[model samples]
Target: MLNKSEISFSFVFSIIVMAELICGSVESLSTYHYFTKPSILISLIFFFWKHAQHLDAKTKWLTLLALLFSLLGDVFLMFVNASANYFISGLLAFLLAHIMYVLVFLRKKKNSKKVLPFTALLLIYAATLFYFLKAGLGDLLIPVIVYMGIILLMAITAFLRQGNVTKNSFILVFLGALFFITSDSLLALNKFYEPLPFSNISIMLTYSIAQLFIVFGLLKQS
Candidate 1:
């Protein structure tokens, strides 16, 4: 049973998640596509700030840095519509943020055995990426390869370093990263190649879920 403050904070976080989804939908429908990422990033900051007292000093700082990098990723992606460079910049920022998360979680835990599954999973994903690229996926190869590598590394790092953190929370973040990867992969597939059915809806769905899970995981950790 949650106290009044806990319940209140949860409600506020839910609203932020809802707002992110709504903004994403509107962006997909309207001409102002740039608003979605920034809007969600702002909501994430607010969500973290609202629950700041519950988090440790290190977690709080890392969360702030992650949000900052996320904002940068959004800004770069929003403006660089011509080439993959902008996307790469955004990817790098996000990669760094993910590394921060891995570090934070590792500091919380030190068991190497817990991460074995994650390492195996990463290897499989890497193999798939290599196969896809070798099969001549065209311009889609670079972005997919980079994104997959970064995300898999993050997951494996977190898995290998699980310490004091709750299993549920770690699972939540791991799943969130998975959804984020799915959303971005779908977007890239649609943009560079053929437009798949439900591409827009899929992106919004996975993106919203990814944010929700990540925020919830952070809150739970705190």
Candidate 2:
């Protein structure tokens, strides 16, 4: 494996390229977006490998799989303009990713009633979002509802980790989960509700931060 400094350099380079592709509106290369959009997840996966060498076996593999699925999700969504099928595929990929995350967080489960209250909080948020999104969802109503449930469960699991891991790990992972939810909520609203200014930049920025926080949190545990 490369040293941390080497990995950091490569990761930063990839992100800069991605930002240029997104923000600069470069149209020189048609295939650039294909590689650039998913580059963030690719780099983060490498970063995870470098830092998680001693991580618990279950959490290590599960988190890695989750990241991989998220990368697929990013790639599939890049072609949303071409076909609606791509968007569904991307949703499926992210659903799987969240499932993987839920599994990883569950490995260190602790019995705490405090986690129950969070379930109610998350449900309320999901319910309110669904109320607004239902009409526009059309045929996607069921799929979107299921996706909401999974991601909500994913967040609940992260909260459930509060008393189970290091404070640094718990706080970072929980924050990351919230950021992930926010990013997804933004994407859904933009696509299903109404367009938001700078939706591309806003969604990707939050998504990138979400993945970083989660990866770093797991590294802390390692």
Per-residue lDDT tens digits for candidate 2, residues 39-158, read 788888887887687888888999999999999998899888999999999999999999999999887667789977888988889989988788799999999999999999889888
| Top model number, lDDT | 2
Q: lDDT of each prediction vs. the true structure?
A: 0.67, 0.84
Off by over 4 Å in 1: 1-29, 134-146, 161-163, 191-194
Q: In candidate 1, list every pair of residues with a backbone clash.
A: 108-164, 109-163
TM-score of 2: 0.89
Provide the lowest-lDDT 10-residue window in model 2.
17-26
Best by TM-score: 2
Model 2 lDDT, residue 221, Cα = 54
